[model samples]
Target: MCKITEELQQIAAELLKEGKVDLVLGYTKGEQEEQSVPCIVTQPEDASKLIFDEYSEKALSKYLLEESFQDKKVAIVLKGCDQRAFKLMQDESRLGREDVYLIGVECPGMKWGEDLSPFCLHCDYRTPAKEDVDSLLTGADIPEAMQGEPLDHEDSFTDINRLEKMSKEERFEFWKRQLNRCKRCYTCRNACPVCTCRVCVFDRENPDYIDRAKDQMAQHQFYHVIRAFHVSDRCVSCGECARVCPEGIPLHLLNQKLLRELDKFYGEYQAGIDEVPTPLSHANADEPDFFGKEGKA
Candidate 1:
């Protein structure tokens, strides 16, 4: 058991005992599995079940958007990426600040099989010091070894570099090949925190963008392009899309490409910073002209 769990449980119990929050949302070991899943504990006794680990991958912030949690004071556990999502939700008015009691934990790079999520690998905000958090818990103190040092922002673009080395036609063919394997299962979109919508345009009944034949090329272009565009400005690069893909497609590559382009074209802007709105969410009349009139066509 992590020491942080005990501290977090103590804090949550205090909150519940004093009626600070109605429910405490945290991770607990799932029945019949080694992985952890989100659990809501209303009673202090249930706080003992709370746990956290690498398997704590599901973004707890996802619950904020659900109708049931509205107008309830809920306590939530947050990793760095999850914290970003929560901040974005609050900024966009999707979730009210008063309704949430945050318990932030310092994240030490969660590991996927071969690669880490782009957000975790390049995270500068691993320590949870957000003003909204009622309390914070860490496995270790802020060590001199960890403090004052810059985060590792080394580019994880090995795959992107390889693709860039290819000719334009070759690069186009590569993506077409990869996307042809898509089953239109929508696992990627469903897993993404930013892909929230009442009804996704992909599955709209009357007006269909995809054809019945599902032309392999059209399928690839439509799904990937639409996914990329929708998340271009808002993606936190959590890698949930690629992690949930059944076919093991490198969907993060497409996301990273868009992230790189946004950084280059606009400025260094992260998706869910509370102080700054996303670049795509706002327009400036004095924007630079990358494509001059002569270069337009």
Candidate 2:
């Protein structure tokens, strides 16, 4: 175990023993080797289960939004991207900072099996600000292969540009092929740390919003388009949407494309890095009308 893991366990144990937190949310070994999964430690003895590693990829902050967490103290382990999600939740008034005890960890760059995850390769914030967390842990056990300098923001779109450069018809066909494979599992929505809707449109039985049918191509397209628009401005580029997608859909690409346009229009904005009133939250009088509709709502 790394020093950070030991410190985290100690902190969690003390907090639980002292009744500082009702639960300590962290990671423990999964059934398989090298697999870390989210777990809760309500007792001081269970604090030994807490560990931080590259395989600890799940975003745990969203659990704070659950009904069971109401009016209760929660100590959650947060990586850089997860910290951004927590910040966004606070900005939206969905979560109160006082109720959460943030145990922030310096991410060593997450991996999917032996390879470094695509999103972590371009990850900007490897560590959270000390002021932002209740307790901070650093000195993550970094793999030598991931020790290089982080990728530049502009150069981060190397893979995304390939799809953007395609012809309009080509892009349509490409999306159709990909979306056709979608089972409408909604894993992307569930895994999204920023998708905090209490009652998702898909979950409701109202027909006016959308039907329960998942077989239609329009149904698939509609789901993605609405979700993409909803999170366009707030996405932290965590890549959880793409990571947890079972169909291997590059769902992160849609959000990244929207974020790129928002950046171009609004001039350099990262969701949690910057203040509230994100680009999509308000429109400028001089805003470009993509649909060429003028003087109309």
Candidate 3:
């Protein structure tokens, strides 16, 4: 096992042995050597199965919302991005802070295939905030150079900027090709930590908000668009949406575009970083109205 993995296992074993947490939520080896999947350890001996590495990319916080997990006193692993996600969940009142223990990781940035994740390239935080977690681990398992340092993050919007340079029709065609491949699998929404709707609009059959007919590309477009807007303000840019998409859709682009527009119109805001009262949750009369209710359209 990697050095940090051993440390994590030790920590988890201690927690489980002491009866501190009912279970420890972490990652363990998957079928692939480079793959890590979420694991739950209720017994101290099982802690040795835990591992930490670049493959520890999944947001474990989402599991806290499960009906089975809601009543348990749990401990969970969180990278910087996922720490933000757990914070957001707490702010939304969907989780009780007292019931969960946060084990923050000094992330070395996760691997997307061989290369580092694109979102990780511009990540501002490689470890969870010191105050935000109960136990914070250093990234000693990674290279000496990659141990939890804040990145410059100066040119973070390069992808969205490239899309902005396209002509209106070209941009339309760009997204058209991307969304066209969507299988309506809802994997992106499922992976998202902030897309926490008790009953997702896509899953509502009573309203039939979106019909999942494979031939209906129009509905596909609608589903993607509406879901993008739905999480625009609350998105933590964890990149889970794009990372988990089976169709390889760059769904984070839609989120980034809307975030930029929100910044321009309503001042800059980082959803989980800042306090509640999200950008769209409130409005001022002075703010520009794109809908043009004053008849400017």
Task: Name the best candidate (by lDDT).
Answer: 2
| CA lDDT scores, all candidates in order | 0.77, 0.88, 0.85
1 against 3, candidate with superior TM-score: 3
Clashing pairs in 3: none
lDDT of 3 at 46: 94
Write one digit per residue (lDDT tens) for candidate 1, span 114-151.
44445565567775566757778888333343446444
**Models ranked on lDDT:** 2, 3, 1
RMSD of 3: 2.4
- The C-alpha RMSD in Å for every predicted model, in order, reads 3.2, 2.2, 2.4
Candidate 2 residues 261-293, lDDT tens each?
Answer: 888877888888788977878877787667766
lDDT of 1 at 119: 51
Q: Per-residue lDDT tens digits of candidate 3, residues 18-103?
A: 99999999999899988999999999999999988898888888899999997789999998889888888898898988999888
Displacement of residue 194 (Cα, Å) in model 1 is 2.0
